[model samples]
Target chain A: MERTPPHPEVSAFDLQLVLEALVDPVRRSIVTQLAVTGEDRACGTFDLPVSKSTATHHFKVLREAGLIRQYYVGTSRMNALRRTDMDQAFPGLLDALTTPRAVAR
Target chain B: MERTPPHPEVSAFDLQLVLEALVDPVRRSIVTQLAVTGEDRACGTFDLPVSKSTATHHFKVLREAGLIRQYYVGTSRMNALRRTDMDQAFPGLLDALTTPRAVAR
Candidate 1:
């Protein structure tokens, strides 16, 4: 049996961990992709700049931080952004994260 | 001459750098204090758990990330949250940062 990795409860999400996970550009990109699509995506489909192991690490960080939810669909891992949960836990966080970056002068 | 340290232009603010600076608890606390008080504060007035050198480093990071502006007042260094600048550059970023920390769970 393929065990689902444990995820932190949304109510218990730590701001530090979420910020730490989001501090990585690759991880932020992953999140941006999900937010842009508004759909669950497969682990292998997103455009990641890092190697396989590195992508795995980023997904793990996102999952543990409760920023994303992952589940297995056959052999492919699907990831969905935990938008509502995160917003409930930390208001405006996803809005901040998903907004267009560095636009003003 | 007590020259003011360089601050990144709001037009050039980088989300990656901002997230990196904000990931630390001490740095976030400094930001929180300014946001909560809505006034400039002397460097020595903040309740930081770190050493003087460490606190100085945190302030430097926050200022460089364009999250705060620092100026000298008499013999003391005063820090002010760059709320307007940040709001213009990265909407919702400060709102998320200033909101209560980890209160959901």
Candidate 2:
């Protein structure tokens, strides 16, 4: 039985939590990929270096932090970057982190 | 005999290290104060909730990450945000994090 996951509200966005979620390179990669592609990606479609369970954990953290929104499209869990929520809560934050200078190194 | 501490080169500025340095609320507060005042301040001037040793540790982390530069003026340790270096390295990162939204939380 699959169910939709919970997400923090835009008003409840926490910069600390967002930073924690983005501190890990893998999670940041997930975000950077989404920002670059500007598309929702399926859980398995991301080129992550971790195991399935680990990737799931990363997605959970991003979702909980309001950085990403997750929904079930058929059997695949699709992840979308919550760019609007992020910008409203912390202006220019996503743009800063997703830019080449941020993701390059 | 006090000596100037080492800082990572601008070219060697690492996002992971910068994120780690900014993740802590206390350290982020130091950064916010700097960004708000736009002035080089003595170590004791910042209003931190941590003890002296903890505050010192925070300064060290910010300094080593190239987020801030610390120098001795007489006997006081003065701290200055390396805005130019950070701007060159990460572009809008500092401005984003030091903005009201990032610091508001």
Q: Summarize candidate 2's per-residue lDDT along B14-35 as a digit string, tens digits.
A: 9999999999889989999999
* Lowest-sum lDDT 10-residue window in model 1 chain A: A96-105
Whole-model alpha-carbon lDDT for candidate 2? 0.91
Real contacts recovered, all predictions: 0.80, 0.74
- B1-105 per-residue lDDT for model 1 (tens digits): 448789889778887778888888889888888988899999999999989999988999999899999999898999999999988878888888787664222
- State the lDDT of candidate 1 residue by residue for A32-74, as single tens digits: 8999899999999999888999899899999999999999998
What is the lDDT for B15 in model 2? 93
Best by DockQ: 2
How many clashes in candidate 1?
1
In candidate 2, position B39 carries an lDDT of 98
Candidate 2 regions exceeding 4 Å error are none
**Model 2: lDDT of residue B60:** 94
